[model samples]
Target: MSRALFFRLSAPLAALGRSVLGLLAAIGRVTLYAFEALSHVFRPPFYPREFAAALLNVGWLSLPVVGLTALFTGGALALQIYAGGERFSAEAVVPQIVAIGIVRELGPVLVGLMIAARVTSSIAAEIATMRVTEQIDALVTLSTHPMKYLTAPRLLAGLLVVPALVAVGDVIGIYGGFLVSTGSLGFAPGSYIQNTWDFLTRADMISSLAKGAAFGFIATLMGCYHGMNSGRGAQGVGRATKASVEAAAVLILAANFLLTNIFFAA
Candidate 1:
């Protein structure tokens, strides 16, 4: 190869290698952070107050958004399914399809993405601001572990509360479909309900909740991880917030695919 061609090819290869190394480093750091935070869950000096606050913030305050999103998504899903089913005169399958679609896929994924957008950004911004203002340092000085105090409570809350959110979202989403199906689509209420009930399996529910827990962990962990390692300044906080949301969303979708394959693949 000519000198110029060799240099050009090597430059791109070097850049690719650097990118791969950076990605691996990030993954390693996040894994260690997760383990360290979980370890604190079993240690002394537990903070009930922080844990309670986290539950309230991560679960209760999240309901309105989750409900609204699921509601609209379910309704839209019903309409689309009905339209599509018309081709084969399978419009009667709306109830079963809606139930399975919402429970198995839409409910968990939508709830996770919404939480990532709302909670993840909020957490990253808050923590990044704290780090910028030396609040994390203050916690360290007071004989408190930052990971135990700040990270553990939120992580635990996410693991516990997100599954509940997913359940609620599933119900609301199914109800939305019910409303659309019976009210406008001329589905008899009793038959529609019966069909929906009959179509859902225990495995479907389990997989949905499992996805919720995984997504919740990913969302909170990304926020905490990026916030802790953020650069210094207003720009740093903003960047951290953006990165946390993007990472949480992508990870949630990826996790959902993996969980779905595990749960349903034949």
Candidate 2:
């Protein structure tokens, strides 16, 4: 009976271990493919039109959600900071806290996560669907490098657009914080403005933008890689979409920690 039980457990354990190994192997291959795609980014026959469309799709279309999220986050952060700071008789620090939190951390991280949810899933679904339809194969047969045509444009778009989105998010977030601080918190408007400006630095803005770019790259890269390498049929597309979002979201958070350490660590 003990032998049978041991065998039953070991059988599933072995299968689980093999599945884990397969996932790691797939990730390694995808990383290599991403590097190869980057190498071809500047090669001849650049796809300007595709890149332009991608910029519009990834950047312009993403603004509303990014803006709304930043706004809500900033407002909520101000309220929380006020409540917490009041306990320590430091309620006056709301402006400075709002500015620092929105510009330095909240803005970039939220935008990254949002894009991971929105853009990564979109790219993965689109590409996976194309793969299912054999459109990718057709592109190859037509002597078109899908890497250059499809992946490069999306990659470049993500790199370029994420920073812009981050910038916009920062502005919206600061404004949101400002509104809550001045209106609900009964802080003097002029003093709040002064405190925010005095507290935030150019380094904070640059760091935020840098984080945006990194997150964007990670999000799009995961989507494109998973989509391109997805399995056969509808199940494959669904799996690719799910995996892309998960990978993008996890990587964004990890990158945030690493980047924050690099930027602010003594």
| TM-score per candidate | 0.98, 0.93
lDDT of 1 by residue, 39-97 (tens): 99889889999999989988999999999999999999999999999999999999999
C-alpha local distance difference test of each model:
0.93, 0.91
lDDT of 2 by residue, 1-266 (tens): 69989989799889999999998997789779889888878787899999999999889999999999999998999999999999999999988888889888899899999999999999999999999999999999999998998899999899989999999999899889889888888989898889999998999989999999999899889889989988899999999999999989999999999999999999
- Candidate 1: where is the Cα deviation over 4 Å? 1-5
**Which one wins on TM-score?**
1
TM-score of 2: 0.93
lDDT of 1 at 25: 93
Candidate 1: RMSD over Cα atoms?
1.1
Alpha-carbon shift of residue 95 in model 1 (angstroms): 0.9
Residue 28, candidate 1: C-alpha displacement in angstroms: 0.9
